[model samples]
Target: MSNDVFTPSRPAPGRTRFTTGPLPVLLASALWGTTGTAATYAPASAGALSIGAATMGFGGILLCLVAGRSALRVLRSAPVGLLLTGALSIAVYPLAFYSSMALAGVAVGTVVTLGSAPVFAAVVERVLDGVRLDGRWALAAAVTVGGGVLLITDGVQLGDAGGAVAGTLLGLLAGLSYAMYSWVAARILRGGRHGSRAVMGAMFGSAALVLLPVFAWTGGPLLSTGVGVAVTAYLAVVPMGLAYVLFGAGLRHTPVRVATTLSLLEPVVAALLGVFVVGERLGAMAWLGMAGIGIGLVLVLTRR
Candidate 1:
């Protein structure tokens, strides 16, 4: 298959695209949803920054290892500016995402970070690729973001005002960073010079180098407890490494805007886990929000 997957001029057949695209992204989102809950099992001495660094740093390295020679070739051949942008965005995302959850609550933090990403992704597509999203995508994105807002509002209590505010800001940053890297990856994939695994491996491998110092500084507490080590390993292997591979593959057949919108599934999964696994309670509004998110996904998926 051509790696130039997202070009406006070379559209894939609708049936094939829709059928093949969404499943991997959805699976990836489901795995990503477990991150917040998994972090809860980490040793108390492991700070949020430590957990974040360890997850991405270790997982990024694993991606490079699995990708092997293809990753090295991509790094050597892909545009340096593009690779740097992706790496920096990847580095920023984990730090902000983890801190946002620690400062705000998991439900609120996850919703805000993920909800804002589609909008940012749309903007990135517009400005960089000159891509104009259709009404269906716009409507789907709006509905999903609205649902995410509702999901967080009354479902979980926030921390002190200042911390919540800071966390919200950080979550926005994380969202923007997430969008940037997603866009970068899609752009590289659309270049037709690299495979999904190669692109992801190259980007994340570069990012691991940037995150190494952070992890070295903060990751000491992770080794202090067996549970912490296990949780960190799970986060690195399952969510960051494997899930992102799935995400990159999905980007081959899905537009950046749609992919980010589809990722709204992550928060939905997270919310459900909170309610059932973590014994958190959700109000009627939260339930309605979940329904709205489902509606939005249906709208996008059923688009002709």
Candidate 2:
């Protein structure tokens, strides 16, 4: 759950100028790659809000304890617009994600949703944020998307099934949520003068507030067994809680492409889990698709 995504540093004497800053940021996505697998066992008792609240709350504790009074000051100063942006963005993933999974299936929902985040981010940055994109970035994106398609088709079935349609829609929503979170987080980071921790903390607090009623009304989790509670706690702590902090912090320090590309490992792991852990079947064609996706993703990550 907790990843070393942000580490303050001074440049070494002979380090490449462009490659300065923390390595933790670049590593964050790889750390985040474990999310889906971990969340598989989360408590059915908890809804997205409760799960998200637990995660944000626990993660915020870490930042608060580390920053002390400064953290509180940052929270106080963060503008209402920025807070709403963070809360709304953060709210999207949990609410829509599980809904998609329930309506569709894991493969259809997760791939379409999470896979498209970077593409959306790239577009938003170019069109709205006024960031420039290079030719290689274009090629990299092409390969990346192609690879994702290969993986999704290979790993998941997407005929005219009712579930597939729902899942695909959910996946689309997931991508949109990812885009919103990235953009809003960027706003908070810049507007708060790098007070990202405080901004995130408040955002989580707001999300928790939104979900509190749901949590109370639900009368607890679907899981009554000990295993259920354990699963929920793990998901809350690791995937939802820890993963977001790593992701947010990494975004603060790393290239968007690097972080997003690395995050692709999530589906790869998911596919593997489907086969080995869950006893799901995959065909030879699917294996080839997985290979292509892995290769394409590697290219995207390794290319200059």
Candidate 3:
């Protein structure tokens, strides 16, 4: 994850202004928008399994090598409880997400899953961790969640159609899992940046191990399909791998609320990408729906 490499450094006095620390997060999110179109190239014959495993493996190795001994220490020094917990918790998302993308389209998969994450994160952090959401953020949440609902339903048609159902459920579950991941990773990174990065990679590796078998059966086909394969690599390395690292970095600096709020931008970005990059044409209503999302984000940023 090249994104991880640019984790914003802690600022000394007079060092960080408003945009000072969020640069990596912004860049990472931008690159993350590239995932959907890229995955189209992977072998249609292969499921998302191979794609998930290969990327995690590659990302883990890259992180381990770059961080060296510090990375080693996260695996070695972690108490049993935390290590097992991290491994088990981290494993759920990639399996859910890549498969979700295969079952649904990239536009649907990424937007739906990540769209729900902040809402879930807010609730989880508030109840489980006792974090609170104030007035403006709540409004922001409503607008964002509403926008997401529109995006997912594709003009607000809610039905039992198999593809739609799979996309909605998987995406919801993925969002929850991602929230958990962010929460747990934030804990590991709290000690220090070096130690944090190491532990995160180790955690990713631990989770990646569980996803290996799924890939074993399907990976060959993925490599055979040029575009899908390229997309898979991009998803694996950038969003899955690098994004996780940068996400960790951002979480370390921002509060759970702010972090969750900022994450809402992901789905909005995905929707835009679908529009421009993938030529996903939206009718006027859909375009208006997307505009609502933009307005919601603006409100979130500016609301007192």
Name the best candidate (by TM-score): 1
How well does candidate 1 score on lDDT at residue 103? 96
What are the per-residue Cα lDDT tens digits for candidate 1 across 49-157? 9988999999999999888888988889888999999999999999999999999988878988999999999999899889988998889988988888888887477
Superposed model 3: Cα runs more than 4 Å off = 1-17, 154-160, 193-196, 225-229, 302-304
RMSD of each: 2.4, 4.6, 4.0
Which residue pairs overlap in candidate 3's backbone? 1-242, 38-231, 39-231, 41-227, 41-228, 41-229, 42-227, 42-228, 42-229
Query: Candidate 3, residues 123-194: lDDT per residue as tens digits?
Result: 877887787678888887778667655666664443447976786688778778877767766666664534
| Candidate 1 least-lDDT 10 residues | 1-10
TM-scores for all predictions: 0.94, 0.78, 0.82
The deviation in Å at residue 186 for candidate 2 is 2.8
TM-score of decoy 1: 0.94
Residue lDDT tens for model 2, 1-304: 2221233454344334223322343344444445455556666555554544444444445444544554455557667676676667666666577667656666656667666777777777778678887776666566656656766665454655886776677767777777776676665665435444555555665655554455455425624557656755565556655555556665564456445555666666677776887777887755665676666565654554
- In angstroms, the error of model 2 at 120 is 1.3
| Model 1: how far residue 220 lies from native, Å | 1.7
Report every candidate's CA lDDT.
0.88, 0.59, 0.65
Angstrom error of the Cα, residue 76, model 2: value is 2.3
